[model samples]
Target: MELLEERIRRDGVVKAGGVLKVDAFLNHQMDIELFSQMAEEWKRLFAGKPINKILTIEASGIGIAAVVAHHFGVPVVFAKKTQSINLDGTMYSTRIQSFTHNRIYDVIVSTRFLGPDDHVLIIDDFLANGCALRGLLEICESAGATVEGIGIAIEKGFQPGGDELREAGYDLQSLAIVEAMDPATGAIEFRS
Candidate 1:
């Protein structure tokens, strides 16, 4: 996690309205080695849990989830933002508001890939307001699956998301928790 914090300090960009863009390594043009290290950290943190599946929302979270699933030796199931023709059978759907995009998306997951037997580890690129993760949790609830834990790459500690999840009794692990950010100075402070 120190590696991730250091990377964020070096490469992360701070924008107005509390946005931290980490596209250079964390999300857009991914650093697989960094992701692998993050995955290893999560694995160590959540050790001994029966995590049979990895779940994440589509788009940014997919790449990180894939590498994490590989490390866990489990299948990764991403909740699609839009329902496609390829997705068949009963689907668990929920609405999620995107903090970055500033839009609400109807996210869904196919029933075939998730069920009561699965113990899932939810992974994502970022957590701000807890909307996306809430939607994914709803789908998991509808499917009657056990949520083993939640793994996040970056979390804006100024926001209520991460704290809310932890208060709700979730075993959430965030690699980098930004305690504060200065847009003008491009300074980021991480929680110790």
Candidate 2:
């Protein structure tokens, strides 16, 4: 987690509208070595929990979830933002608002990939508004899967999402929590 915080300080950029662009090393372009390290941290954090599968929203979260899944020796199931022709059968779906794109999407997961027997670990890159993770939680609930934990790469602590989830009794772990950011000065303050 210290490694992630340092990396964020060194490479993360503060943008207007409370956006922290980490595309240079996360989200868009990825750092697999760093991700592997993060996976180890998450594995340690969720040790002894019954985590049979890793769930995440499509796109940004897929990379982190995949790497983390490898550490847990579980398959990663990502909720697709859009339904595709290849998808079939009943699906668990929910509407999610994107923190970055600022749009709402009907996120879905195939019923075959998740079910009542699964103990799921939800992973994602950022927890801004918590909408994406909330939607994923809905899908898991619809499938009757027990949520083991939630792992986040970077949490904007200045936002309400992380606190809300914690108050809701989720076992949430975030590697880096940005307590505040200054778009004018490009300074980021991390929670101690």
**Which tens-of-lDDT digit does each residue in 23-101 have in candidate 2?**
9999889999999999999999999999999999879899999999888999999989973434355888888776567
lDDT of each: 0.93, 0.91
Best by TM-score: 1
lDDT of 1: 0.93
TM value for model 1: 0.96
Which portions of model 1 miss their true places by more than 4 Å? 83-89
Q: Determine the backbone clash count of candidate 2.
A: 0
lDDT of 1 by residue, 46-142 (tens): 9999999999988999999999999999999999996333435588888878767778788988899999999999999999989999999999999
Give the candidate number with the greatest lDDT.
1
Give the distance in Å from residue 53's predicted Cα in candidate 2 to where it truly belongs. 0.2
